[model samples]
Target: MAPAQAQMGTIFLLFIGISKAINDVQMLKPIDLSIEVLILGEVLLSWKPNVNPELESYVVKYNVLIKTPMKEEQYTTQNNSTKRMVALHKGLCAQVCAVYYEREKETARSQWAKAKLQAPPGANGTSITNLSCVIYTEASNNTAMDCSWLPGEEAPEDTQYFLFYRYNIHLEECQNYSRSHDGKRHSSCQFAKTDIQITEDTIVVIYVNGSSKHSTIKPFDQLFNPSTIERINPPMNITVALKQESLCAEWMKPVSVWPSPCFTYEINVSDWVTGSTKQLTVKDNSICLLTNSQSRYSVQVRAAGSDLCGNSKQWSAWSKPVFSDKPQKASVLLLLFLVYGALAGIMLLSAVLCTRFQLHRRLFPQVPAPRNPFKDLLSYNEAPTEGALEVISDIDDPEPNE
Candidate 1:
């Protein structure tokens, strides 16, 4: 009887194992994916878990996919809920599924659960087009965000447009606005020292909307990660000098909140003598080139944040040019001296030879005319030369008689 009871107990344990294996392989689907609005342009996604007590020891993770007209993103996480900040003006859809896995392989996967938010109602062509934005760090450590857009063709003339930004939990309405030249129609907005905290994330959302009596104006929103639209500042205090025969340039980093190490520079050297321009990109603040020192150059430096900080896509405008000392005036002075010295040397030699050899008198000796019989008939105004010829004869030594 004892052996029979023990055998029965073994069979019962085997039956329980078979049932558990069947439960583990059963396909469980997730339920009710939902989006909970947290704030403007932000939402929380939550769903019911596909739990199985039998698979307690195995790890279960959820795969979430968010889709938009422009792009789609997919990620896996162990949590059933996630928080996201995204542009909602165009609307988005999200889907989630449960994945059951062990240390080695996936045992099972649940079906997908989907949720969607419909786009706001408006005419297709009434939404503003060509929206762009730029963010910059001011000298006072303040952050400014500038955005501009073109009016939609279908939009009404008197439609009043407004710009707003959402950062984390804060939403700001742009108070400083710029109007188009044709009319008082708003076309651009600037946020000076935005109360919205500056951060390195894709959470910042810029939204533009308007009210119109003629038709419903569609709103527009875009996500920014801070670096994409940032406009770096030009490098500061560019100084150029010749160092040990090298053309060297130096400058401080741009006026930004980031440290010097977080920036790189682009240096432009324009040789006015050779009429050639050279450009160098360096991670360091100072650069030296073995260039023609005699060639005067105009150098300018521009800076951008590096990957160490948030790298910028746009480079700053070029800084004011700094000129190196004009090729030394000493070279010109030396050339003039050599030319004058040669002329002076010739003059001195001529003077010495003239004093020693009476050169001028030998080359331009006075000639005496033959005594003419007619000279007696000429007037006495002509000076008599009969005795002058004998005095000039001594200037030339008499040659030896042949």
Candidate 2:
């Protein structure tokens, strides 16, 4: 009986040993589990391989962690959650961890990888600010101005920045000129390309960060004209005599002149008839002057200086032209006399009509004749006669003086 019991016990021990050895072999074999992180759109997550010989499937575990300069936050999965975790911001730095499993055994966790991360190139996420241009009086041209943006929290010290420029002549229309660099944390750069000559009503625009600002300047010629005449210094009343021949002309200056004149006088003649223009520079004011022969000549005097600024005063309005040939004096006098006589006749006719009207009003007055006050009241039988009055008197006196 003892031998039989020992044999059964040996068999039981062998069974237990075999079971333990099998479990150890399973644990020694590596589970085929691998993880890969992928970023798609807004969500970032990990994926596992399905064709591993050892693992029928994989159990993936993931968590998101945000690391900013000021603070950090961590989120985990719960309640059978299988979807990929979303990032808080595209510009913020983040990390993702992924774990792989095969059936009941945990295999491996992937190394944390950068997830949904973005770092702008410059301070304040912008390279340039307040980019503008103005007419620089020192440079005798236009120049650009700009300010640097403040540094962002996560940006590196060695980040690079690109500066761009565009000029708009009209609203809603833009033209790109050139681009430059803001090296080593510089905030602004003067645009060296703004050297073009600006005309009247020219609008200039500058752009930065996909936005724009504008300025305008008027033309220089409109603001500064060299042909403007100054006021005369000393007042003078001078008579100008003009004479015109077929193609030549002559003029006489005023008999009176001012002392210590600062400018030299010149005579300019423009003929509309022949389409010719001539100028004769005169050193002294003279009585007689000759010009090129022209049918119609406009004469004026100019005060000029030899300095760089050139002449300052233009001549007064052109003098009336005089024909070279004299007309018949007798005929001109006759025409004038006829005109005077006609005007006198008209005046005399007006006076006669007015006098006749007055006389008519006086001779035939508008007032009616005086009317008799008792005409309507008196009747032939009712009128008191002289005999009635005498009868009354005789009655009143009684038998008087028979």
Candidate 3:
């Protein structure tokens, strides 16, 4: 009796499974899945539902799958249409299916209907390549943007590229264009503070299209998040001071056109005495180290967007290095230099004066000489009287001879 009961149960399960299979086979799929371009990079996907009032009325929802050249996405909605922002340069493929859910459980699903959009075809390597962009957010909340790209390998000499971007509802063109290679083709573009608006929910769309005399230059488009591509300025007012036992480093966050909730900091401290270096990562703008002694230190601080704007991998450049007690030491050194310089100048002047006086004495020496003009005449007269005496003595001896 037990074996017969088991057989009956197995047959019942088989009947249910067969009935389900037949029901699924007869279920109709969604019809006429279509894509409509709302804007440059935004599109709408819509389809007609398979409506049958004879079937039990359960809420139907759609499952949408999007395939792009770079990535894929899936979404579920109760409506027959959905909107999305995506790059349209390479086109995309979208598929939608209706799912039947009863009592919060999936009861059945229909077949998938697919649609395709074909981008304007061109030569293989005629599209722009290696495009990059950056947004500069200053401390005063001023903003600017810069973008650059390289021409495709098969691009022609006369190929000129134009750039357009959109973040919110307004699409803007590049006005301050920077050209490359003899100014023949535009390779870069710049935007002023008034051109863009950025927020946490903003999505940036960049498009590049080109024209050439020889060939058709294929266009390229890309999507970006403002926070991810932003180049944050380094932390300002960075100062390190010695407070009691710890060397405390403090700074202010970078200013930008939009306010940021918080920031992460990197403080690199180098000990002048120990000849060692340290890397410190912190969430706040201030940090302190207990060096035990009053040893001088060198420090630099750099910052990045944090919290809602957090980007751990993208860090600003390190700030210029600041040293503990550097200002006092510099002033002392300068004062000593001035004092020593003045003393040396004085000594040099005295030495020169003494040397000049000694040189004068050696060039003109004192001598004992007669000052009277008639002294030489007196001497001549005395020398002549001696010759006269000798002549008189000879005359006296001549009398004896007579």
Name the best candidate (by TM-score): 1
On the 0 to 100 scale, the lDDT of residue 318 in model 3 is: 89
Which is superior by TM-score, 1 or 3?
A: 1
Stretches of model 3 off by over 4 angstroms after superposition: 1-25, 194-197, 257-261, 292-296, 307-313, 326-402
**Candidate 1 lDDT over residue span 293-383, tens digit each:** 5677889988877778765846799999898874555346667999999999999999999989999999889899898877667755667
Candidate 3 lDDT tens digits, 79-171: 888999999888899998888776687767778999998885666688889999988866556768799999899998888899998876878
Can you give the lDDT of residue 395 in candidate 3? 44
Go through the candidates in order and give the clash count of each. 0, 8, 4
How many Å off is the CA of 20 in candidate 3?
Answer: 3.8
Compared with the true structure, the alpha-carbon lDDT of candidate 1 equals 0.81
Runs of candidate 2 with Cα error greater than 4 angstroms are 1-53, 77-90, 101-108, 123-402
Comparing 1 and 3 by lDDT, which wins? 1
Candidate 3 lDDT at 86 equals 92
lDDT of each: 0.81, 0.40, 0.80
